[model samples]
Target: QLGIVTATRDDGFVVRTLNPGGSPLYSVSELPLKLARKCLDVFGTASYDEESSIHSLNTGYDDEVSSIYGAREFCLLRTTSGKVLYCGKPSALGLKQGGNAGSRWQELIVAKAPKIAQVAAGHEGLHAVLVGDDGSVYFTGTARRGEDGD
Candidate 1:
């Protein structure tokens, strides 16, 4: 599918599809001006810089948890207070088993990790790496199984 991803001046993000042979499945002009601005804002200024200070960042998805579910995608966001926010396509976040269907980003009430420097999400959106200011690394989510299946 032909799609165009763009960030708007209003701090929002949009995804539009373009038809191969037609003007577009939907016209750009007809597209909604506000799409996922709130979601995009969750990541605003949420990055961690080890050189500056120890900040926490939430990485999306946990493969270990997703494996139990249906391998749904999720977004993770960390706050200044070390609170991790989660949202996405999954209905439950591993522990709980039902919600608004991941329609909006929500904070993980039980997750709190302070003094975090950086967080990196895995390409599969199943795991994340947390780097502490002291250069310590922490891994979360599912682990890659070895040939022995240990």
Candidate 2:
């Protein structure tokens, strides 16, 4: 299967696709000129010389975006404000809001921790783990809570 990676920049975002052999398929910036100006404005003239903080937007299958067996793929996004969003096929046990024909990005609600630092989804895209800045971990998706019979 193919793999896709999305990274956030000071200005905008970047997306890259890879072939089954892991070779580069194509790379594109969400917005080039606007991103450049945004970077400059935030970091000043030294922005060019400085490194932009990059985060690897991972899929439910860990680092890879798409599944090799043709299962539905899901992408995770973390905003600057620490909000986590999900985009892809809907899971029966996952949050069910914010999905439409044109967009699938949905806000994942963590009762224990509203602010998330990172998140990882299962290969089946049915379960996920979230880590908060305070070092607390939370679980969501199709997994049943507690024992089977409670």
Candidate 3:
């Protein structure tokens, strides 16, 4: 387990792009050594700018604005396979990265967790206003203005 990962390639592929970060993303699966090198370039050249990254990653909206305690900013993630998701993070979790609730795009819905329906961002955190089929709202995260939710 030396920990050197490699690519599984195919034929009829070509090198497509190499980012500024030295990460080489390829299209040619036929080329092994070159493909791996290109893939590495694509990964390495990958840049991370805070605001831009966050905006780009915030893709969709399904979660509604809420008065829930932890509800922060959110997104609706429909997988390529066509699964609907209403999700977000609590203020406590939102404040950190790699917490239990992480956004898929912007809204992170953990499997087995309740479906977070709506979200409204607050000054310190966000509010997740959740609703079950019974039409009841469950408030969990922070409210925008110091509990007053002003």
Candidate 4:
């Protein structure tokens, strides 16, 4: 089965996950431009030295965005516009989100270099962790107010 991603402008997204011994599952679509902008608003400003388009913007994350599980991990991200972004890892769990951005919210970048099992979204930012046999929780994206410290 093939997993297909779908996206909407003002509304959320839905994706179709095709798997064996399972029914067709519809989920959110990929990060579309409009949706990307909504996400950016929540983060802060969309910075572009020169390589940037005015319509929509997004970044998976660089060597930044950390998870308690490991360094250079992708946490959940609240783009400037309020769109929710998540990395395809484990299945979506209790994953909860609200209207407030963390006092020190950080960007969520999914690390694709290594295979991921699951990921989740939180207040300040996003949190991601690898799947454990016994099922213990890992940590990521714990932003404080400011550097001087909030």
Candidate order by decreasing lDDT: 1, 2, 3, 4
lDDT of 4: 0.35
- Candidate order, TM-score descending: 2, 1, 3, 4
Candidate 1 local lDDT, 10-56, one digit each (tens): 75666776666675365443244565322221222211211233333
Q: For each candidate in the order shown, give its overall lDDT on alpha carbons.
A: 0.47, 0.46, 0.36, 0.35
Give me the candidate number with maximum TM-score.
2
**lDDT for 126 (candidate 3):** 41
Which ten residues in a row are the worst by lDDT in model 4?
41-50
lDDT of 1 at 58: 27
Model 2, residue 28: distance off in Å is: 30
Stronger candidate by lDDT (1 vs 3): 1
Error of 3 at 33 (Å): 41
Task: State candidate 1's TM-score.
Answer: 0.37
Per-candidate clashes come to 3, 0, 34, 32
Instruction: Write down the worst ten-residue block by lDDT for model 1.
Output: 63-72
Roughly what TM-score does model 3 have, to 2 decimal places?
0.27
Question: Which lDDT value does model 1 have at 86?
Answer: 62
Per-residue lDDT over 11-95 for candidate 3, one digit per residue giving the tens place of the 0 to 100 score: 2344333334434543322323433321101111111212323233333443323232222344333333223343343344334
Q: Could you estimate the TM-score for every candidate? A: 0.37, 0.41, 0.27, 0.21
